[model samples]
Target: MARDPYRLIGRIQQVAHSLRKKSDHLLIDSAGVTTAQAGILSVIAGDPGCSQRDIARRLRLGESAVVAAIGRLRGAGLVERRVSDQDPRAVALFLTARGRETIGRAQETYGVLNGLVLDALGVGGRARFAELLDALDSAVASFPDRPDEAGPPGPD
Candidate 1:
């Protein structure tokens, strides 16, 4: 996008930062929802009786993070928590009518933002981009913490 990445200038981290900033700002302005809230809402919309622990595992967030976000969503009247029928100690999450409406708005906004990427990448390019991204994700997942990663390139 800005010449090949070298260290910090053209790296994907910069692109991700810019994209997140703009998208987050736009969602906050137009949808009355943050990205995190929208994601949580979507999860609940998909699974009407999911627990907060389920959300934490699915979103790969800490339990505390899910708890805090759910607190805010509850305060906003977007989500309601009820005692689980299967486990009295656990709470199940459900989206309120307002949460569903906000999630719909957020989806519309995301499609609008994704439209820009589609136009830039074209249809075929987007497919290749997704494939490449998945490869990168798989490769980087469970990366070792030591500096031994500085080895020669492997077969790609």
Candidate 2:
């Protein structure tokens, strides 16, 4: 018998929601930031001088959402924006000293969460699970109506 695909989708959503809730709590307690904010910070931390468009694209978020997050981060002195050298019309994002510190704490929190997930999956299972997730993502990307259909999904 064919398995119900919707059941798998629902399970995926449930697991994601649970993990997001836990991550939000850990992030709030560790860095006084929301998971969304932490995600933007982490991306900026990894790619200094990246544009807001870059962040939005990489995070699969809307431009306005990324703009708002950047506004909050700037207000909190966790992020700084500078004129982009590549595009004068665009702005580049950088993590401030405090932002780096906050990101360090956020990384620790994520590490704990990662450990929990890996422990649950076991060492060998972790690798296989990651492969499965990648395959799923690729399959979804292959759908004809996908917005960004230029090519297949790249490695995470």
Of the candidates shown, which would achieve the greatest lDDT relative to the real structure? Answer: 2
Could you tell me how far off, in angstroms, the CA of residue 59 lies in candidate 2 after the best superposition? 1.2
Clashing residue pairs in candidate 1 (N, C-alpha, C atoms within 3 angstroms): none
* Per-model TM against the reference: 0.84, 0.86
User: On residues 1-156, what C-alpha lDDT tens digit does candidate 1 reach at each position?
Assistant: 575445643477878888888888999998888888888888999998899889988887888999999999999999999998898998899999998989899999989998998899998899999998898878777677576756887899
Can you write out model 2's per-residue Cα lDDT over 7-124, one digit (the tens) per residue? 9989899999999999999999999888999999999999999988889999989999999999999999999999988889888999999999999999999999999999999988
Off by over 4 Å in 2: 1-5, 146-156
| RMSD after CA superposition, every candidate | 4.8, 7.2
